[model samples]
Target: MSESYEKFEGLIPGDGHPRWGQSYYYNAYDPVRCLGVFIRLGFLENQGEANSWVIVFRNGSPLFTRTNLNLPHTLARPADGVEIAGMRIHAEVPLKRTRITFSSPDCSFDLVWSELHPLADCIAMTQDKDGAFAREVAHIHLEGTSTVTGSITHRGEMAALDGKGFRDIAAGPRNWDALLHYRLAWPVFDNGMAFCGIRGISTAGGSAYMRMMHDGEAWRRVTAIEDRLTFSPDGLAVEHAHWVFTDELGRRHEMTARPLFGWLFPFDTFVLREHMMEYRLADGTIGYGLHETGYRLPWQGMAD
Candidate 1:
């Protein structure tokens, strides 16, 4: 029932929804250059700001990590593109492709993402409150695929971006702290697939809304979900997780994940932890993606 909402590629979460948020995000790894990029632009309507961050990783470790506490929400141009405070993400080919440019005193990058696979859908699982909040959170993950190219410059050294990447545009009214858990994984598998849902790893109550995309189509829109997550005592990572999703067709599929690395973002209200992981399927193929856990975790000593 979640996916009945139509899919669109242009700027979304327009002028309504007072609590709305829209995120334009991308992640890619360049094996030859041993560089990786993960950037996110969070447009929050209520706050009238775009809280964005950029993490540039080199040789498996972070080279640069920076965040913009608040960029004006006016930067979210859903039609042609967005340009805000030295960062610009404009369309190169409309629905199927885009070019992103980011410049700052420390480093800069210009990249293009060209679509290779079609779009997929996934719902964000939250409480069944029978209200607009549930409707807003339930609509998440308009996913896509692309090959990235261009250049990344840091500390006088430069590297070309010739990598495969996954992208998603998430839009909705969000009371982020109220969300306890959701898992977004896109293990870099040759199978050309991705999955997002909620199953294990929640102390507070929440429901399930799992969905999977395979080879540019809806592989499964889940009707039932089961998951188990084991987090480290420090709450910095989800060390292991297993999920079984039952599709609307009543067939079940399983997937397992283990972490490669993770980061924790502490806020005044909650802690957000996300890990990059390697996942294995029943067929023995492996892929890489993120395991993100939201809301408060058992972390003891981080400042807001």
Candidate 2:
């Protein structure tokens, strides 16, 4: 697969399906400052709508958040940048390096993301082209771990941003109503090892759609994942977790996590609770990233 493909670089013109959509997402957090930033730009081409979200959190609560769930899809795709829904995502090196900027009354940030590892093709982890799990998610998914550096101004105070980050591009039909419940975790450790795993219950049954990792040397697809998570009293965020992953080469990796901060994101048919967590490997190296869970709206049933 070529990384320079148009679909990987920016928004596709249109795929004809009303449900077809594409999204560019990025996040980075500083453990010392207990601060985190997450940004997303989405385009629903067939529907002629766009969605953008910018959220910054201090300690454990949101300092500023700008959510534009629907806006006229007046998007501009420059040769090296993307402008949509009040945000500019400029790529200096396509998928390897990016500068994302946003400005609003309450908050603003200009952050640069540099990929530290090769992009992972999440769909390959499924090993099935026509599987039920693949159909429910999307047709394309690419992700990478990155190092973030820049600055953010929130409520009149500016702060330097230095932290490990994660970015991903997803496209195709994402039928939210197909999922009953799902959990997604992407953690990058201090030693350079990282994991991205997802498991869910869909109408067809249980499936693990994404299970891959960077072992500091190379990327490998994990054969199985066993995860146990405990949520907060309100069941809206993760409190603690224990995970075990079995790689294709037959090695067992284990880790545990405790939440540092959490935020809730709701859109369309799902409510997502994204947690910034501090994780400890069995050997005791600490790391940070996102632990997210998605639940379908109880009122919506599976596609018939």
Candidate 3:
């Protein structure tokens, strides 16, 4: 399955839209060490530059962060991998295996991702009168769960990481300011169940994209999602969240999220608050992954 679309598309000719871009995001968490890392590498060929955002967390606080929005980049995908700002994401075997590496004055890492499941395509079902899919979220988006193992050296202290992780790649025209608000969750359970869902509101309308992979089963599209969330006093972070996803087979799967720690990344249009959450299923199964929300700026809290 990966043989078809795993290769990077690089920058394709667009309709001269400034938002034409391609990006890849990779995340890993070491449950034993309570450490996690998030990396987003993006290229805006129309603008002739790229962006690299890397954040490392320990015990719920940011240990290291690097955000470079203005950096030289290549117009096409390099044979080795997508290298920018001293970071690289190379596909060792398309979707089956990948190698990620980075180096800096204070921190460096070499991690390998081995997929536990095949890549799942996020096909949006909601469309507006103008026929926009997921409010034109992305032309192509794919996500999956994996087993990550590597070593990270920070401040001369090396830590061996072995745990679960998640990754996604997206490409096409994307306007960061198009959405008024959004909520997303991707939890990979220890029992082999994984879910990836999102609900976003835009001027066009509300859009939903959901997919889940059951243990030893193929990915299934979720028909509907009932999302509920609780926020901190500042409304900038999530206290907890509950969600009921209805799969195509008419089965309801419920899950609860309790955030362990969170970090914020602010953009001109919105502030992305991301948390490494501890998740619990109705059946008492526990897991870990990312729970993220996007709110438009000026610091207004979550809508009532």
Candidate 4:
């Protein structure tokens, strides 16, 4: 189905369910070698303050250990001229009993908790409609006695974390199930291109909605729930799907999404899911994006 499309005007109120207070994103890839990395940091308002964290999946496995503690709010821009907002965190992996550190001027941070799972594998793939790109799978066997540290900058915050020993098993699904409601749209690369999408359920009753931007210029909102879904799992040897977004403004956009890889943590009863998507405009120009989700629901408890 085709509709009149316009440039998305960034994130708007009442767009989709905002997952956190404000969302930050970064996606970089090497198209020639088919390798890429995608990262996202989400902030949520707790009481009168904002509590935020970072979620990154390198290749397909959880890149950094998950932490529930809130990092100190600070801003740091290193020599690279990258600005990050957040806190510096240090974590110890119980499994390998290793330490890692994450320091950055951006909004996110990274550290190696365990050398058991290393970031070495590189997958093959193409760019997305929004310029987002990534590898199909990362087969980096990070197992050993080692120390690694890295930092990420996003959403106007900076933070860092460091620790050693990989205590947690790197393989398995981590269940993250929570009902989220928010809207988001960001214009990067000098606003020459942009993309926006939303997924939320009503607070009162059975109201739910999802929408996306087509060319970083047009706004397409999906009104009918039944008409906003598309499933395709046979393209890249992985489960694939796309959703149709139609905004309240009568705009339309098509979003094609696929899982980069899946992670299941049987011990902790959690699942870490990562997906790469491509948004194609009516004119056929493409945009790329990465989505990382955590599912923790009642069904998970039953299985446990």
Candidate 5:
């Protein structure tokens, strides 16, 4: 079957409403350690401001919260004092051909969208002393507007921002109307340490899909897996799967994916899920990184 791109309506509760948007990133190292960061950006219908904040999480829990700062920015680690931002940020997502120029007394930079694709978005810009880094952005578009305003309250923390907007979509309280986007890098060990790009999608109907770069190959749709999913007591989950991919060459490649870690988020309408799977050839050889899942997207301007 061809790759399915079915449209979903109200997949997210308050998509396209006037409110701040939040993006999160989580990184998991080989053995048994992981770190995550949550970013909140204010968005209005026709206005833009400098109100953005980021929260860090480690080992499936909260670590620290940084307010009024640029995202993917370096932060000091409390454990070893070693810089982890370099590994934490994979890529930057853009806001659909949008550009933002920021100027301060000591520094200034321009955020421009250099690439736009159906799977991921890239925003390119230069920071204070750093040369250039593209910010990869992703989000779950909601369906409606909110009634509250000023300082978004998420996970019991009050975020102060420069705009008047309500809860475009409820962030907490475990509602199901939410969408998710996950990005990660896959290292292909068999072919001279070659790496492939992988992404996942999660939607409302409990349906998910994974897209990845297949050794300079085109996008392929995975049909099924050979294993079951395992859940942890703390809500962490993992699984190993064998996927059957049909590529553009009209050939099928059977690859085994050993999941290193999984990230789970509770949504309003559905439970969002993502897993970092290590792809390997059927003969027990490492191939690439496979990030897979799906999410519901808010539907707008649709005719019945």
Candidate 6:
């Protein structure tokens, strides 16, 4: 059952958690067009509240940015797709492909995302410490490729965008501050290589994992908990991301990623700092991806 993807994986259950519901997230960057975007929608099951955040960037500068909490929202599945406010997200091919659209009086997007590789299966996030709560949010990681062909309007400036980007859908509780800290990154290069890495600390414990897909075969599965990434002085505001890791085949992979432009967002649950970076490898291969840092718990203040 876990082999093939499921359409409902992208949709919400009829009734959700009472305290905090789930969220749907997706982000992408197409370097050629100098375009980048981030979107998140969260539903609070018990409270009947919905929260959302969105940002669109051109040449590393924000073109549109907005964050709203407990907004009066009506989420419904017209047929099988999910709709909130004026946004519509429908899975066109079960787990394989999806169409996401947002059209409000102020902002809009028309984009399609196709799963280019299988997501990591759900796993235990920690062996000790806050293992149970940690597993609640860090269960699975879904990675995909996106083609964004839309114009986002903000402050009366509209920009046309086209780019290749990364996205994810994780099934878990929506308690953002409950998490300690973690980072997830996947880069789909022009030369046809898709790579992903994730790791973080839970109150009880922590975990790290990595995977790569190339030449049309499933990702090699093994314990990949040895990746290391270092940042510059300004951290999220800077372009430096030095990465080194050993793959499943005992091969060393290393690269330095630099951002063309940077973006910052202090969301309701947590704060995110991002660098839409292009990477340089040992073999002189240059590729595009993102460098990001997230702060959970104390890093964010209580929602006012």
Q: Using lDDT as the measure, which candidate wins?
A: 2
lDDT: worst 10-residue window of model 6: 121-130
Q: Of models 1 and 3, which has the larger lDDT?
A: 3
Better of 1 and 2 by lDDT: 2
Encode model 2's per-residue lDDT on 1-304: one tens digit a residue.
3655434666565567677877788989988788788888777778888788878887888888778888777555423687765578887787788898878776788989988876777777657556654676667778789999898888789999889888888778767778877888889999999998877777556665677898899888888888888866666667788999988789899999998777777777787778888889899988899888887776343221
Per-model lDDT = 0.64, 0.78, 0.77, 0.30, 0.31, 0.59
Count of clashes in candidate 2: 0
Model 2 residue runs over 4 Å out of place are: 4-7, 75-79, 299-304
Ordered by lDDT, highest first, the candidates read 2, 3, 1, 6, 5, 4
Q: TM-score of each candidate?
A: 0.80, 0.92, 0.92, 0.39, 0.36, 0.77
Alpha-carbon lDDT of model 4 = 0.30
- In terms of lDDT, model 2 sits at 0.78
Runs of candidate 6 exceeding 4 Å displacement: 1-4, 10-20, 72-79, 104-107, 118-134, 150-160, 204-216, 225-238, 267-269, 297-304
lDDT of 5 by residue, 1-304 (tens): 1122111111222244343233222222221233323333322212232234334334445545445433342222211221232222112221112222223333222222222112211111011111111111223222111111122234454333221010111111122243343233333444432222323323332223222323433223333322233333433343555445444346555655665545444332333345545567656666333344334333221110
Worst 10 residues of 3 by lDDT: 125-134
Q: What does candidate 6's lDDT look like per residue over 1-304, in tens digits?
A: 2654353354455334444355566677777677878777666656767767777778768767777776664454322677665677776765566677777666677777666554444232112223443345533444555554566665556666666666656544555565566665556666665566655555444443434443235554333444445544544454466665555567666666777766666655676766678877666677776666666635532111
Over 109-168, each residue of candidate 4 has an lDDT whose tens digit, in order, gives 444433322221011111121211111111111111223334444455433323221111
Question: Can you give the lDDT of residue 7 in candidate 1?
Answer: 34
